[model samples]
Target: MGVSKMTGKFLKVKCGKCKNEQVIFEKPADDVKCLVCGEVLAKSMGGKARLKAKVLEVVR
Candidate 1:
């Protein structure tokens, strides 16, 4: 069998300012921030998250 796609997926992103790597939801309920440094990694735009950091990979 193959992996089926869901409604949302996890993303691996690196903070632009701190270069800190973190995993966040594609559609986050709230704004996502960097753990190491307080940086807006992803901004919650109601529906989908607006990515501020560089996306490293999409987690399956």
Candidate 2:
């Protein structure tokens, strides 16, 4: 048996309005919003999210 590592991509973004940092999926099905502030971080565009804020890191 082999152990398979789960590989996934996530984006660490910061909210422009409230300066809140959050992690979201790169290709989100829906709009990604900030938990602290009611601001849209990324908007869903078919398959991927159109980032509306600054991206801090890319988690693998």
Candidate 3:
């Protein structure tokens, strides 16, 4: 599903390497990283971080 399409949610995405929290849309992404430590989040691609999608609850 798409993030913009998914309203009413705060997409709590977690970093794969540092376990940091980040918000993202459901459309998927690349180069997603931790806002705090600048860690390479998501999956690693030849040493670069690749984005991965995670589901979050939409709190109304």
Candidate 4:
């Protein structure tokens, strides 16, 4: 069998409240929060995380 490319990815995001840059999963199991501030950056949507912050870059 051949290996297949995965769709899931890591993302670089900036917190809306604190403007803190953070790295998160595309599909988070739980709510992703800012490291600097206690603000929700991404909300788990059972699939792809619903981003509450600004997406800076998409990590491979």
Best by lDDT: 1
lDDT of 1 by residue, 22-44 (tens): 99988999999999998999999
Candidate 1 Cα RMSD after full superposition onto the native fold (Å): 3.0
Which digits, one per residue and each the tens of the lDDT, describe model 4 over residues 7-50?
68899999999888998988988999898998999999999999
Clashing residue pairs, backbone N/CA/C < 3 A, model 3 = 3-26
- TM-score of each candidate? 0.86, 0.82, 0.37, 0.85
TM-score of model 4 vs. true structure: 0.85
Give the per-residue lDDT of model 3 (tens digit) for 8-58: 333566766566667753333355556877764455353433456343443
**lDDT value for model 1:** 0.91
What are the lDDT figures for the candidates, one per model? 0.91, 0.85, 0.52, 0.89
Between candidates 1 and 2, name the one with more favorable lDDT. 1
Select the stronger candidate by TM-score from 1 and 4: 1
Q: Write the per-residue lDDT of candidate 2 for residues 7-60, one digit (tens) a residue.
A: 346889999999999998878888989999879999999677899989999966
Best by TM-score: 1
Candidate 4, superposed: residue stretches over 4 Å from native: 1-7
Q: For candidate 3, which ten residues in a row score worst on lDDT? A: 51-60
Q: Which ten residues in a row have the lowest lDDT in candidate 4?
A: 1-10
The C-alpha RMSD in Å for every predicted model, in order, reads: 3.0, 3.9, 6.9, 3.7
